[model samples]
Target: MRVVVVPPVPALLSRYASLTDPVPELRAACVSAVAWLVEHDDARIVAADDQARRIGEELLAQGLAGRVASASERIETRIETGNILVMANGSARRSEKAPGHLDERSFGFDSEVEAALAAGDAAALGGLDARLGAELLASGIGALATLADLTVTRAVMDYADDPFGVRYWVVRWECAS
Candidate 1:
């Protein structure tokens, strides 16, 4: 089975850094983000197997609540030379007036974390998983499973006030060659 796992986007450094704070709000946001994925980001997700797509559709449908609006969104998946790119896999507020934009920001890693990914250190990556996971959880986003294949990602979760909101996250996973 071909599976694509997305972990937390890396750009949310400040929001996620404070582990001491009790971030009940962030945890709830993570759940909503998952459900949002199924609803808004289906088009970008691709699986060579039809069964995988079917499963994805089911999960997406189940993610919707009565309050969530029906979206005409799509998810895209592309295979590059040594990595896989999964993008446009979440919600966005498409208003012309206040088009909340999100950018691909690399993880502002401290020297230690930087050295690890740069040097292909597995232990370093594992260490990052713990630290990053805590940060993500603090930001109302949860870290999903980390793939054995080394994939890095950068994404943004941007939104305005209550009624209209835009939130999304993406993670790049290296597929076994």
Candidate 2:
């Protein structure tokens, strides 16, 4: 079954980055956030079918207990039939029916995904992973030891044209269990 799975917002990591200046914390957040993506089979939330939605919800449930975003950031998760979309905006909206261009203002998952794909740099993924990992640690989730344990499964490009301006990449990571 096909699914449109939106990646989770690494709320914990983002908040931690603002509160602290430690590099290890940032790296941990990066690993944890990307590792979560790996478990989902390198999914980029564009749309979803019935089976996909169910699967997405089950996966997201695992991370609910460890939310790391601040009050203002306010991350949100929702499942619709076969479409699972997670965002920090607290609003639910389907991808454009006709498939239009993605604006730079499109939000977290899409923007990052787009930029990552455009850069086509493996190093960029690692860099972002490091940054996110550090952010997560600052948020007080776990140590770098945990993030380092994650395994990156696969990386793929879900490409589309953007009318906005700059292109982006959406790198996926699979962690070691």
Instruction: Indicate which candidate wins on TM-score.
Output: 1
TM-score for each predicted model, relative to the true structure: 0.24, 0.23
lDDT of 1 by residue, 1-177 (tens): 122322223222233445664433433443354454443233233332344344334333334332245432322221222222221212222233213432222123223333432343424544444434233221111112132244334323321121222333322222233
lDDT of 2: 0.30
Model number with the top lDDT:
1
TM-score, candidate number 1: 0.24
For 62-162, candidate 2 gives per-residue lDDT tens digits of 33324433311221322222221221111112134312323223345334434543343323333344333232221111211222223334434332332
Model 2 ranges off by over 4 Å: 1-150, 168-172
